[model samples]
Target: MSKTDFSASQLIEIAKALAASGQNFIWVVKNGEKTEGEDREEWLPEGFEKKMQGNGLIIRGWAPQMLILDHEAVGGFMTHCGWNSALEGITAGVPMVTWPLSAEQFYNEKLITDVLKIGVAVGAQEWSRGERKILVKMEEIEHAITELMVGEEAEGLRNRTRALKEMARRATEVEGSSYCDLNSLLGDLRAMNLPATRTG
Candidate 1:
């Protein structure tokens, strides 16, 4: 969830696929943040909300992401593969449909799908920067979502992600990696007790 980076047509396809798949989804669109006079009303396909009213919801601007992802109803994430969101999804034990946008996102996708074995890629293999954005076809989005959510492969992905969730939780414990690193940094700072005049 940082962003789906979907094009207009792709958004329509996502709507179609979500409806057809009969899965629950919450799509976050920053419509309120749109520039002056932008066509926010047309953001989704016509009748999209009513069509998928029972199965989906479009959050116009913001959402409590951590709460949503940690909810029992949430099964998978369609993510931009940003490290923070990726880790959050993992901590929540939610598998993902990776649609990387730019910077280290492509690399993060590899970690999610390859190294971590927790997600499936959405066929967006290149960076789309500047004024141009990568146009991920509807077919790819649909296929990726379907495969990760209901396909036979989904079971394993779900199990692996749950395992990752435990590991992430443990990492914050008293002697875990994150805790150890934090303590080490604190110790180094305390050791650096230079002259009070200079330190202050």
Candidate 2:
């Protein structure tokens, strides 16, 4: 994953874009402490609060645990390619627009974008060498979000994710592979429960 930073202005821009797109029920999670050295009002763009008041854009400080992502209303995720987030999204059959933020995150992006085909990489910065900053402009962010929200690629990923989720469910059913493995382990345990051989 590559290191990246964003100003409050940028976040506000994103919120505005989401609003302009007529997105309903948009949720954003961020750090609680407001960044210093900027005007408080400017931290959030003018009219943003109004747009969110009844239009469905929700902005909250602090990261969401499991609720928002799991909600059916969540059609897309703008993520910092964490492995756990990737797995959760896949399991929930939610497609994502990945924004890697570290070395391992770059690798995870490969798994998501290249291997699993469940996500799209958005304005990825090279992870090689000492280069630390990979900036993604608001336009790219808007484009990626739009693409992932509604497009052929997004539909394909959604279908694939759903299939994968179903397959995972089947793997844990009573007659499934994991179930059989568990049964086999139980049998071994039962054998161990038998009386020990006297000659042993």
**Which numbered prediction scores highest in TM-score against the true structure?**
1
What digit string (tens of lDDT, one per residue) describes model 2 on residues 113-132?
78988887777685644433
- Please list the residue runs of candidate 1 whose C-alpha ends up more than 4 Å from where it truly belongs after superposition: 1-6, 33-38, 194-200
Candidate 2 clashing pairs?
A: 1-102, 1-103, 1-104, 1-106, 2-102
TM per candidate: 0.88, 0.73
Clashes of each: 0, 5
Please report, as a residue range, the 10-residue window in candidate 1 with the lowest summed lDDT. 32-41
Give the alpha-carbon lDDT of every model.
0.81, 0.69
Q: How accurate is candidate 1 locally (lDDT)?
A: 0.81
